[model samples]
Target: MTAADGVAATVDLNGNFPASPPGSRSKKMVRDGPQPPADPTAVGVKKSGVLWADLDPCDEGRAPTVNGGHADTASGANGANGANGANGANGHHAGHDDGAPDGVPAASDRIDGVLEMLETHPESRVLVLYTGGTIGMVRDQSGALAPLRNRLASRLRSSPTFHDQEYAKRRFGDSDTGPLILPVSSEGRRVLYTIREYDPLLDSSCMGIEDWVRIATDIKAHYEQYDGFLVLHGTDTLAYTSSALSFMLENLGKSVIVTGSQIPLWELRSDGRDNLLVSLLLAGCYVIPEVTVMFGARLLRGNRTVKVSADSLRAFDSPNFPPLATIGINIDVDYRLLHRPKATEPFKVHCKMGSNVGVLRIFPNIPTTAIQSFLAPPLKGAVLQTYGAGNIPGNRVDLLEALREAADRGVILVNCTQCTHGRVAEVYAMGKVLWDIGVVAGADMTPEAALSKLSYVLSKDEWDLATKKEMLRCSLRGELTAPARVLADWDDLDAVVRALGAKPSQTASLLVPAVTCAAAARRGAGPLQAVIDAGADPAAATMEGRTPLHVAAYEGNLEAVRLLLRHGAGVHAKDRFGRTPLVDAVQMDRHEVIAALRGSGAHLGAANPALGDKLCSVAAVGDVQRLESYRLAGTDLCQRDTCGRTPLHVAAQMGRSAAALFLVSSGVDVAAKDLSGLTPAELASAAGHHALANALRSRRSNFCT
Candidate 1:
């Protein structure tokens, strides 16, 4: 017998195709309180509305069929593990009686025999995440395709290319609603995939942060249970979703391939058939340990991908980065390009992503107020799409100042280029000005990756501003490639590195600073050294995190700071918080460390927020020795907290007469008033430190005289 006929023999088709797919829901997708009677051909006797076909069991020693026939009560394939019609949104018929025996179930119910996630199997088991898209679409009453539910599953089950009836019958008997196992491939690979369709399928253009989080969270929930995942998504926002997933699922060790088609699967010549077919193989038959986009004939790094055409079959590409794999006559995976996570490291999925970030594309004569308002409050970060090579108009001083103010306010602004296929370089004067004003060069990242990475960085409550800025510029995933031209925008070390990359007349030490700030955020000598030795730009090094120099100074790693400095790390490098190593050193009065950084030509960070936190804390606790140390470090001794309480204000309020004496003797404002309009002496009086209040008032009067 032919394969098609052999496959058709397992189930019964009565030529009674429904106006809609069986188990289809209404436009609202609302569940009915009381369901309708059963359709005779459906595997579930209780399933109502309409039936595409009836699934039957084998002969005497086998399972039963649901076609006005006796039940295979011993096998019980359709008894509990049968088709459900609760979603049969078509209301019940008045007089049409469904043909069923007296003891058979007549009300709609869900199939209760789902495969467990933790179930063991030798074959590759994939969770087919059927989110609403072209691949899972069907024609409604108006002949317009919309996101479908069980129809795609039904199509796969009915197609011999997708399911092996004999194999499934031997394995799961008459329960066709369980895992849909595919026929063995020529390479001896068989895939067992289960469909987990999303309720009220989402459209391609409507996906957002919360939707991306939902997809990632689902993958995490079934992470250990499945070998891989295949996401059927709409084509429009597919790239954004993929890029967002790449950031949301950190340290991922399994494959997450997002795929969709231009034409709906319900169409006669649908591209979704091939897209879904190949995506399934890539997800289940291979091990690519990173989030990826699989479409047309290429598998690309998720963060590096961009949609190339709106209607072409070959729709996506990783313009800057090469495809991880190519599928033509044979699937050719570039094994070297795959991200290999350490086996010992547990995979973590970041569920929380801040949504305060936005994208701003720069154009000629764009209003300064426009950018100011766009980058204003509620926007903590932004992806600035600039002119070629990351340039801003040098003549727009107002624009420059507005951006500078935003950066100063701790808004992370990442600079990405407007071109489709090149890295952002700081070759122009204005580009350098952007770097100087604290705009992070986004290198070659797509706008999707840049914005998502920005949100991810800002959501990290533990990382300081310095760390966030450093991370925004670095490669956390394979999203961007920092070209050598970026060196010119950095310090002396990077300029030298940039020149050396051209094989200049003279050569400096190959040991210029490189590596993500997140990796060696604590030490400059260990992880930073290792990555630098492996040819990382010590100054530009990042692993989707902060710079090593930023971290070394923040953690008071005196020797690490020295190590980085001795190796030509940028002494003037600022963290996302705009604090230079010198500023961090001055914050804690790291005397010898400050001297070392200053000796290396480091300057104080401007408008730095790490200004007076340490001073206030020490003064509040009456740590006289620490206060003395800050005075020697050249601290202004006048920095205020959020409430406008200066160090002297804190000292007076805490009633530390000794601390107050040190501050007043250091030429501090003895009569400094707080936000409450209460002077230092008044604060001391209010707190019942009457003796200290008198002493402070005497000191203030002496100063006035």
Candidate 2:
């Protein structure tokens, strides 16, 4: 399998692996906590009442008024970048050190000591889609706050913090239609962006499956036009929209950040300006490569996030997931938390998001009729936000039967916890009862994510009830955490195997998945032998879909491969990427392992065609993590795309200078020409990426014969 397919985080070496981004997650962090993403925002206030309007997460929000003649000099903080603000009507907060070493070179420079990152790429074109939120709100004649439509750009231009008039005039002289240029960040790259406003605008509470589809389609329509996207949404259901988009935008390889504010931009005090500026910077300067939420100083995974506070500025948090990147003196991205997909196809927008879904928050003495009615016809799926650890009132036989009937009728019910942290598992008898009745465990997924995911999963018309139920358990996006069956009870593999005794086959079946995971941690012949002697299955794979044999080849453990081969491990068995153990060895340049695999009857043509296609896409998207994996896997960097253009050609044509530079360093054919008889540099020039074209041409002589 190729790097694009299901791969583990075991081979982390300077961002050369998918399991972790370089320096984002140190091995120490990987072993300690739940690995990463998700984000949050303000809800108007603490929702209190006897009951919700409906059992579903409804879009009924207090309609905001429009600011027809709002002034530009509104209130907000001078942002963390120290670029756009003078001071807010409320106050200002100082920027803190991101803890990155001070002498670290600017993002545009040839970074020393560490491997090249996509951040080194210059000049990002971004699309700032204003879908209406508190960010653009202003006081109306009635002294009420309302989202202004079609006038966000005008408001942004009024403030020097939001728009740098001097930089724009200097950079785009004589061109009145030049893209707005954000003040260069400390990382040293400018975000050239265009603002697209929704006609009437929307409060996120009004967002649904159709709205999610619209946003996803917009991104797809202009997918190649911009480097990334920043979505401004209302806080009430921002997390829900984020979750919906993550699922809808399948196979995504670019950043999509959703952010808004607790207060309006034109208010005497607001956090809107700071939120907007940071979202712009992140959308352009860095390659986060997942749907994220940026608020306060945290960059989170969109789906995993929940709106924690009603009026507080730091409104969102992902209790089950950690922040992907923290905004401070510098953005500290936990590279390992970034979502790298196994899908090799082009980025697609799943527009068919099913809307016949709702949420049912279970409580004490809830009626059976209500449960039956909620799961009635026309309602295909639902999120059951049950008691802690996914328990329901076990004594209520009527409630149990109602759920069973729903399951029999093909209605999908996912059991998510009402508690803030932890996932739903069948540890308790009550929980097990739900599982027996076909309630899918919603492991650590927020209520918003659970509902949104239910909509997406049920919309898959081709998938049957069984497949949909299984998929609900699987992590399609970073919406839910992967359930890892780890053996945390034992400190080491050998000790555990020893404790199980010499003939442990009967118990080994239960320990097989854990054994495969232990194999990745201890990549040696001694440990493999100890575990094998204890009768752990050799074909078993970890939660990441990597077999023990794959780990041996990845780690270049020749002896480990030999021992596994002797035990009849599949040398040609494919992983998620259609990759064999031999291909893993081939990519790692482990000649000794290569020889051993061939000796064990591995085919010469084991390299994946899917790998090449994914590699080309990664380069175009400037995904340094996946690209680094391709390089380490010894993937042919000279491979061509559908247009007969190499990855270098694609990167250059797409203005992905950083990706192109990475291709050059990885020994791609820089002098090669495409179908148009255009060199990589020529393609860059043809596509108007002048600086990138010039850079490629300058480096071409180094590879000349």
Q: Compared with the true structure, what per-residue lDDT tens digits does model 2 show for residues 31-106? A: 0001110100000000111010000001111111111221111111111222112222223322222223567432
On the 0 to 100 scale, the lDDT of residue 394 in model 1 is 94
Query: Candidate 1 at residue 667, lDDT?
Result: 72
lDDT of 1 by residue, 1-705 (tens): 111011001111232211221122221011111121121111111011111111000001111222224221111111122211111122121222223347543222111111111011124567888888877778889988776556788888988878887666544445666677777654344577888888878897888988888899899887745657989899889999899898888657567999988888758888887787788787766657678998888898999988889878888889899899998888887644655432222356887899999999999999998999998898899999999999989999999999999999989999999999898888889899999999999999999899889888899999999999888877777788743322222244556656556443212223333333544555446766665565554444232123466666656677676666655555533332223455556545567766666555444311111234335556656767667656554456776532344667657756778998888887777776544455677766655577988898888522310
Candidate 1 worst ten-residue window by lDDT: 52-61
Candidate 2 Cα lDDT to native: 0.64
lDDT of 1 at 319: 88
Question: Compared to the true structure, candidate 1 yields what TM-score?
Answer: 0.54
Q: What is the lDDT, from 0 to 100, of the residue 636 in candidate 2?
A: 62
